[model samples]
Target: MKKYVYPSEISGTIAAPSSKSVMQRAIAASLLAEGESRITNPSFCDDSLAAMRVAEGLGAAVEKKSDSVIIRGGINPVTDTLNCGESGLCIRMFTPIAALTGKRMVLTGEGSLTSRPVSGIEGALGQLGVSVKSNNTLLPIEVSSILKGGTAAIDGSMSSQFLTGLLMALPLAEKDSVIKVDNLKSREYIDITIDVLKKFGIRVDNHGYNEFKIPGRQKYTSTDIAVEGDWSGAAFLLCAGAIAGSVSVTGLNSESCQPDRAVITALRKCGAGVTVEKNVIHVKSGSLRGFEFDATECPDLFPPLAALAFYCKGETVIWGAGRLKHKESDRGAAIISEFKKIGGTVKIDKDCMIIRGSSLTGGLTDSHGDHRMAMACAIAAMGSSDAVEIDHAECINKSYNEFYDDMIKLGAEIK
Candidate 1:
């Protein structure tokens, strides 16, 4: 456990970390491309590393440098087992790609991922002519047979990643494929996948987030791509600035397609002093008023938005609680439970999360082994009357490993 206390006023500039979402998808695309793909500013977070490992297991040669990674693409299948290292994206995205080889491959991971649902993986892939067995929809899934591209009706309410895997895998099938998605949440993530695929020389036709048409027997052409800064991770920093003091975060793409970029809208609605200039976002402490937000598309914003709501006036209601059940934690409950320890009042009703702003009396809380929960508590603690202690603080490494160090650079106090 680590305890954190913050100075009343925090001020500085910090660069945002690379987006793991983009980096992981790029790694998968690189594995399917025929030649060497150069990825600049690659993320070294655990999740990104897991994707790299998965690529290598499937027979791609990965060379790592300080600032970039070189990947030579081919499905050589050097290993029969792929360890996803607790990253949900790695498991969901790579399982279908593995099935493309028509060989037995076991997909497993550590920690919460072992218990996370994979029925979507089994059901969706099974429909596409792949044999899959799982631990009652959990990890350690065994799959075989080459994927045959056809029509698959996928339930997208739970996650968009399953659709992403199908999109990435179907292009190589011998026949054309069509994906019909129902209630597709986080559609922007799928958009990111399509955008990355287009950059790698693959074509996918998306029809209003409902249906996707993919032509089979296509090849991924290698190219040099730069991974953008992560808005999901940077939202915590921007929230910290809103609640504690003024902070400027650089390197975030103002035109980023990342769903979590909606953080700025929430902050502005709550009366935070926010301004976007060039490639930087400046957030400063200001008088705040609670505002309503629908996080159906950008569910990752719930944590930081929840934390920011605690400092705003009146009650803030965030929609889309249904989207939180399968994340790193039951994030809706985790946010309500952890924030309660700090003297914040939060409640969930149906698909809505309600937060009543109040002064925080920082106290001990557990992260529920969730990265966003830990960072949310840490950021909320900054404006609290006392220090906050977070158990299993290291869980932040699953995504933003340098979270605390980045905060410290912007004048956060921790030990």
Candidate 2:
């Protein structure tokens, strides 16, 4: 769905998308829960759907509704191999949970996730005594083991999803264990994991980002869960509001531990008029000043941050460029390339991206098959000479399936 967005000022209110990061973890917890569990505001994106399907395969009776899902837990492995679709998080997170059953399971995915590195999994699971077979950790991941849980030390510099998997699966083992991680990035995601596990009656001795201790033979209890609004997706809408006009986004908790919630902080630093109430986040266009942000724990914020940087009066610097290498595209580079095509100046030096604000001429931009990139381009339309012509724009379905339609509701000139 190639569409164009005319230069437009947007105003009004829109609800934030359900956090797929939260939703997927909720689904996994619900599946591990022993009884019927209902999750409100479940995400319906591609990655969320992949997690739902995995829940179904694992013996949970998953009923999807317009706003929620009922998961009757106790998985019975309906299929030999489970397809994780295009979600890197799903494959990595669910693989260890699958190992808990001591069943031989094959893991595969589509597109970038299939091509994304999985070398992290082979060694991590191997340390946990799970037998794995793979083509140098490039998909067709086969694992079977009794999963005698013990101490497994991991290098977490690459991704946090694998650690998320170990944390999820370790509790079900017959013996208590410890997972020692070094140089863990995305530690905010680990906070979410621990939060989800707590609701399911699992406790871990969290030694910051370095070590996690899990008690064995613990069974998860089913409970009602409410997914928080996604800061990653909301960052795009918030950018739309700040670049276009006054737009209010509801459903974000100001107290969220999710690192991407720092979008509000970055917005404040960029000089956007922002307000925080009980459950809603509000932002409006204002003269933005150049600001610096360390996105090491929230690399997903890069795209929207780039969009916001385009409207600033001077140069904006964002850290954590190294973490963008394994995303759908080289995200840091993709943001630079796409934004620069539309009259923005972007440069990469070491582990930072410098975006210089200017009068952007948004004639044409491409999403590079990255959903965040797609929304970033759409948000950049607020500063376009005319409507931004976006190619491969439909990739927004990866997280926010109704993004353009939602934008239309909030007065974005998207057609």
Worst 10 residues of 2 by lDDT: 379-388
TM-scores for the candidates: 0.98, 0.98
The best candidate in terms of lDDT: 1
- Per-residue CA lDDT of model 2 for 1-415, tens digit only, reads 7889878889998888999999999999899888999999989999999999987887889999998899999867898688898888899998988887788988888877877878878887898889988878699798897677998998899889999988888898889999999999988899999999999899988997899999998999999999999989999999888888988889999888788999988999999999999889889999889899999989999999888898899899999889999998889889878888889899889999898887889777888888989998888888778678999998899999999998888888888
* lDDT score, candidate 2, position 414: 84
Name model 2 segments beyond 4 Å from true. none
What TM-score should be assigned to candidate 2? Answer: 0.98
Candidate 1 C-alpha lDDT tens digits along 108-198: 9999899899998898888889999998888799999899989989999888998999999999998899999999988889989999999
Q: What is the clash count for each candidate, in the order shown?
A: 0, 6
